[model samples]
Target: MGLGGTAKKIQTLAEKAEQTYQRLNDLREEVEKTQETVTETGDRVRQLETEMAEQRAVLDAVAEEVGVDLEAVSTDAHITEAESDDEADDAGDDGSADTDGDDEAVDDDS
Candidate 1:
């Protein structure tokens, strides 16, 4: 082959190799960015889980302090239980029936 032809072929091959290198570098950078985003998302999920666990613990403690059985409060049974007319009348007369009984109940449980 002529020297000019050989030089032109070498130039074409070099251009193609440089373009492939640039594309590979861009793809590598994109992969790194995706990895960083995944890591950040995982950290956020873990933080949210920890916050939820702490809030649940606080609620459980409050439920215990208030003489409320957490399982009963969480269930539908409390809502289904109806109040008697006598109980309602006692609750309305002095308001002490509700507060006093609740305080005594909590104290008794402790």
Candidate 2:
């Protein structure tokens, strides 16, 4: 081959190699960014899980203090009924009940 043809071939090969190297470097950078994002997401997930566990523990402790059995208080209907009964008892004992019309009239003036 002529010297000019050989030089052209070498230049073409060099260009291809340089392109390949640039692509490889770009791919490495992308992988590193992906890994960093994944690690940050994992840490956030762990923090949220820990916060949820702590909140659950606080709720359990409050339930125990208030004489509430968490195992037994499973449904909204049961909670509503219990609250209604408590309110009825409190009203009955607080002299707020109008057993007769006279008691209501006395309350109306005040």
Candidate 3:
């Protein structure tokens, strides 16, 4: 090739390299922002867990004072929740339009 052709090829390669560098820089910035967001989310989650632990401690103390068996209550609550979920799933599977009032009444009685 002639010098002119060689110069054009070099210019195109340089432009491509510049474009690649810009893309890499943009990706790096996005990664940094994502890391910061993840860190902030992790901090919030840890804070929430700590608060929940504190609240649970207070709840246990109060339940003990009121002569309530916390473990039994917890187990009963889980069983009731599971039953409700199962009933809802069954209703959904049957494809029947069950009225909300009936469901609410059953839930209130339990």
Residue-level error in angstroms, candidate 3, position 99: 26
lDDT of 1 by residue, 18-80 (tens): 999999999999999999999999999999999999999999999899898888776656555
- Per-candidate TM-score against the hidden true structure: 0.59, 0.60, 0.78
The true-versus-predicted C-alpha distance at residue 58 of model 2, in Å, is 0.9
Backbone N/Cα/C clashes per model: 0, 0, 0
C-alpha root-mean-square deviation, each candidate: 19.2, 18.3, 8.3
What would the per-residue lDDT of candidate 3 be over residues 1-110, giving only the tens digit for each residue? 69999999999999999999999999999999999999999999999999999999999999999999988999999999999999997777542443554665555554
Off by over 4 Å in 1: 73-110
lDDT of 2 by residue, 5-110 (tens): 9999999999999999999999999999999999999999999999999999999999999999787777777899999998996677555465664766766765
lDDT of each: 0.83, 0.88, 0.89
Model number with the top TM-score:
3
Lowest-sum lDDT 10-residue window in model 1: 77-86
